[model samples]
Target: MEKTVMIDGKQVQFKSNGATPLKYKMQFRKDFFAEILKLHKLGKLKNLDEIDDDVLGTLDFEVFYNIAWTFAKTADSSLPDPETWLESFNEFPIFDFISELQEMIMANIQSKKK
Candidate 1:
């Protein structure tokens, strides 16, 4: 609340105020993204090629695209809610499916070399 958070040896401001409501969240996001873009313009954004290991978080875009595309792929299936679908992905079969796919690809590659 009173103290500043340090980044690259510079003190950044902090606030202990309650979270903003969902209605205003989008505006906040726009402002946040705008600030990111501004900093990027100001040459403050970190280099993607040389990002720190601790800051590198896993992102499975294929899983996300699969979930989104499935609804579009099926002519009659109801579109899946992104939030709930994401929850389901974290819960089960998706990870297993990806594992099986990895094995299948490995086997196919091995088979082709023979």
Candidate 2:
């Protein structure tokens, strides 16, 4: 699956495909599915104030950026490293956009049964 979202007035394309997981693992040196599951805890919360400090303390917020970058990289092979790519954007409204990515991530993992 592919999506184009506007960030800081620029159109950014993100892709999730057969190679997405592998790209994520290779770039971040972390299991894509495992990292994704970590975000599930945040998804269950009614608000940030409701977070359990014990869990929030250990959460790597960078995972959010890494996941976004991985999908962006998958869409455009020539994109620079994550940091540089992110720097190009004046504002990256990740919180607003992550939910969209969550759906794409889920679709990537689902299998079509005939």
Candidate 3:
């Protein structure tokens, strides 16, 4: 899959097992974060009541979490704070997928703020 976005000062550079270009991947990821951030800034991004194809779309939570994990791992190398996720363990009873995602996004923003 293409990881198109700039998580930190650096662009998303992870290469998934696909025949996609690095630039394309980064651009897609960049757009994803941009949208997520925009919605977040508007305070519209929230946890969905449920996890279904209509909710998360074709994007599986596993894939999304993995990407977030990569960013957290890399960001943690330089950032030192709980605000930024850097890394997170799998928790159960996460009723809403968006809640977890929102947390991740918040952590990313919080990390940037500091």
- Please give each candidate's TM-score: 0.23, 0.83, 0.29
How does candidate 1 fare on TM-score?
0.23
**44-87 per-residue lDDT for model 1 (tens digits):** 21345544454334333333233222322232235344455345
Better model by TM-score, 1 or 3? 3
Among residues 3 or more apart in sequence or in different chains, the pairs in candidate 2 whose N, CA or C atoms overlap within 3 Å are: none
The regions of model 1 sitting more than 4 angstroms off are 1-76, 88-90, 100-114
In TM-score terms, candidate 2 sits at 0.83
lDDT at 106, model 1: 31
Cα distance off (Å), candidate 3, residue 83:
22
| Candidates arranged by TM-score, highest first | 2, 3, 1
Off by over 4 Å in 3: 1-45, 50-53, 78-114
Candidate 1 yields a Cα-based lDDT of 0.30
Residue range 86-113, candidate 2, lDDT tens digits: 9999899765576667778787666787
Worst 10 residues of 2 by lDDT: 42-51
What would the TM-score be for candidate 3 when compared with the true structure? Answer: 0.29
